[model samples]
Target chain A: MVERALLLCLLLIGFWGVVAKKNIIKKIFGLNILNAAAVMLFILEGNRIGSEAPILESGLAQVVDPIPQALMLTAIVIGVCVTALALALAVHLYQITGSFDIETIRERIQDET
Target chain B: MGKRKAWSPTLQACLAIGAMGVVLLPVFLSQTPWPTVARDYLMQYGQDESGARNLVSAIYLGYRAFDTLGETIVLLVAVIGTMGLLSRVESLVNTVGDDDNTIQTVSAFSLRGDKRSSHVLRTHLLEVVTGKIGPIVLLFGFYVMLYGHLSPGGGFQGGVIIASGIVFLALGNQQDNTSALSKSSILGGIESVSFLLFIIVAMSGIFFGKGFFGNPLADSAYPVGFIVLLNSIIGLKVGASIGFMCIAMMGGHD
Candidate 1:
């Protein structure tokens, strides 16, 4: 129960950080936090009520749903890629301009307009 | 006046908290018990089909290996894109003179100004946290990836953990050189090796005359070990790909 709540908090914090932060780099940090929290939540959710065995089982028994765990794995990899791409864009944006702040970048872009 | 000015921050805080409460409510409220039907279906059919007791591995390596492959490709594309967009080769050459100027500014400014005190304070705090907490997180990530076959984590989960650790390193040490540790060649090599290993493992069944990506000799004693091996391979691919992608983007930047 406590673990679940912690995971929930992580999810929320990550979301909050991404949405609220203005600095592009800080926004990336929030996205990472959010991704980490979501991945942790999926792993924790896959936990058997009392058994430590992964969703894998060899014999005739009810194992945990490995599907979500598997899906989450893909999700984690994709998340990392997305974050990297976003950060790379941020760096490029920084280079073309000279600031990590999103508002400044936006204004500089607008000025070109 | 101070209190009056606090409302903006307070309002921001309130909106943040409220948004969180709303996002979390549905996830918490809608709970479903693990279905007994799934448990039985997997136990009976998965062992015979995948020839592994661990149903999760069967699903991971067998059922959804395609998804894994797609994710790996996503990472590969990300690195390539980052390299194209953010490679420091041009910047390094073009800004060599500017780099020296900034370095001089940083060093000189540090020595004789009030900024030095704050810089020293920040450096000390960074050293303290990165030195202490960083290794623990890295180790935990390794354990998560390694023991994924037996626990809740697998290659994907563990890979992200490891990538996060690398990100932590980048965060603490903003020096461009620190990021170079995850070089393109090194990361590219690890990513390819692991990916190839996965293909070989999956094709083992085809070579052995079983079904496609199926293990004929899986039942006696070695199938379990093979599954575990494949899990580790997947972990390596996912972890290295993610680590490489993250490092490439940041490391190659000016």
Candidate 2:
């Protein structure tokens, strides 16, 4: 219950960052935090009553779900790729508009159009 | 402007937070963790079927090899997209002319700046430290990739580590004469070749009467060798692709 609450709090914080922040980079970071929270939630959900590391060693009765761990690995990689792509886009936008502020960029686009 | 002013930042934040809370409330309240059936199956037959001691490796390389392939393709697309974005700046700089002053100003504007002309920016300590530790880091990445089947670390982790070592080297030494374009192309070629080899291996499983990505060498003496091979291929592809992305994103301003 505590873990779930912590994860939800993290999600809320990330949501606030994304919604309240004006800087595009900060929004990207907020998105990353959300991704991390979701990954942790999945890993936490996979914990069993008597779980050990999912290695094939002798004398191990229970093992945590390897499926969630593997899936989370994929999620983490995808998050990284998405972050890189987003940063690239941000850099390109910054180059063209000379600002990181979303509102200013939008205003400039409107003026140009 | 009037419409935008109606919703202040604090109000927007509160609304978002409240909405998220409401959406997540039920999920958090009724969280009954269920037992996974696949866990039992994987733990029981993972070693014999996949020949990998590490259960995660068994699942990643054997049971869900297709997903790994898809992930590598996603990485490849990201590398390509980053290169596309950064190379435009490089071309813009080149077309602007041969004037050194203009080139310096343009590169500075483009975020790569002139590294060769600015000698004072070079720090001797960083150069020495990276030179000493870079090879060890690369070796460790190799160790992780090679021993992935038996250990916790795998291709993605090892590849990122190797890419970081390359980044450290790139940052520490500015006097290297190799053009960024050539280096990027070489890395791109390696990425493509490794991905192709991965696909070929997947196809070879079909040729051997096994299903696609099915373990053809499961009955062989060294059953785990195929997983090792797949891990190495993925590691090389990921490392090269990431290295290419970093160098490309740094732009060819050097």
Candidate 3:
């Protein structure tokens, strides 16, 4: 129960970081944090009361849901691609305008327009 | 000033409603027993399709190979689009020629200036492991792709695992090997090979009177293994394509 609450709290913190971070690079890092928190929450949620192995065997004990674990693997891959792309975009944007700050970039774009 | 005054009341109302929606969503979600529903569904229909003990892998690769294909396309498209956007063929090469620019800048220098670093990792253990274990993992990922039909893994997972191995080189040997490693022609070769292989697999159904992307080889003797084989092919394509894409983007970026 306490673990569940802590997971939720960390998820919220991750969300806050994505929303509140000023630097575009930091925002990408925040997004990665948020993704990690979501994956952790999923794994935590799928835990059985006393499941033994994710690999289903015949007669030992209850097994946890391997679905979320498998899905989370997909999610992790997609997350990596997303983070890489975001960071790439950030790097390119910085190269263009010479600023990592989101507000500064927005202002520069506005000036250009 | 007029726009600010005009938007204030509407914005306040939207914020209040949005906050309420966020608060109420979890409350509504908690009342349902979704996991039990999923489990019961899996127990009924998941086993035969997925040969492995892990039912999740079965659903992902077996029951939902179509969706996985679509997901692979998304990653592929992202890599291609990034390459189109960032391939600074002329200026990037010129930038790489500078000797003074190679120093690692730990502080905020001029924003317009690009810094190149030839800093090697000080850790001896990392050098040994990355040199040895990295290529082995990449080769193993291909094995995972080939054997996904009989085992607990598939193409997407194996492909990403292989990409992770490639990332080690990028981090370890973070020099201007981008152009040398990520040649556009090489990426084209990898992409076309996978795309052609996928089309051939799908078209085999037409030639052999099986359904689209159907296993012509599967019969009562060992019907399911062919689908797993298809999964592996898809996995190999996706994994190699992504690995090459990441290297290409990293290499091309100035």
Best by DockQ: 2
Q: Rank by TM-score, descending?
A: 2, 3, 1
| Interface RMSD against the true structure, candidate 3 | 5.2
How would you encode candidate 2's per-residue C-alpha lDDT over B146-199 as one tens digit per residue?
998888888888887777676555555545544342366677888999999999
Candidates ranked by DockQ: 2, 1, 3
Local error of candidate 1 at B90, Å? 4.2
The lDDT for every candidate, in the order shown, is: 0.64, 0.78, 0.60
Model with the higher DockQ, candidate 1 or 3: 1
Q: What are the TM-scores, per candidate, against the unseen true structure? A: 0.65, 0.89, 0.74
Q: What is the interface RMSD of each candidate, in Å?
A: 3.5, 2.5, 5.2
2 against 3, candidate with superior TM-score: 2
Q: lDDT tens digits, residues B70-147, model 3?
A: 666667676666666556322433333345446422111111213333222224455456546767777887777666
Q: What are the clashing pairs of model 1? A: A56-B54, A56-B55, A56-B56, A57-B53, A57-B54, A57-B55, A58-B53
What value does the lDDT take at residue A19 in candidate 1?
A: 73
Which consecutive 10 residues in model 1 chain B have the weakest lDDT in total?
A: B104-113
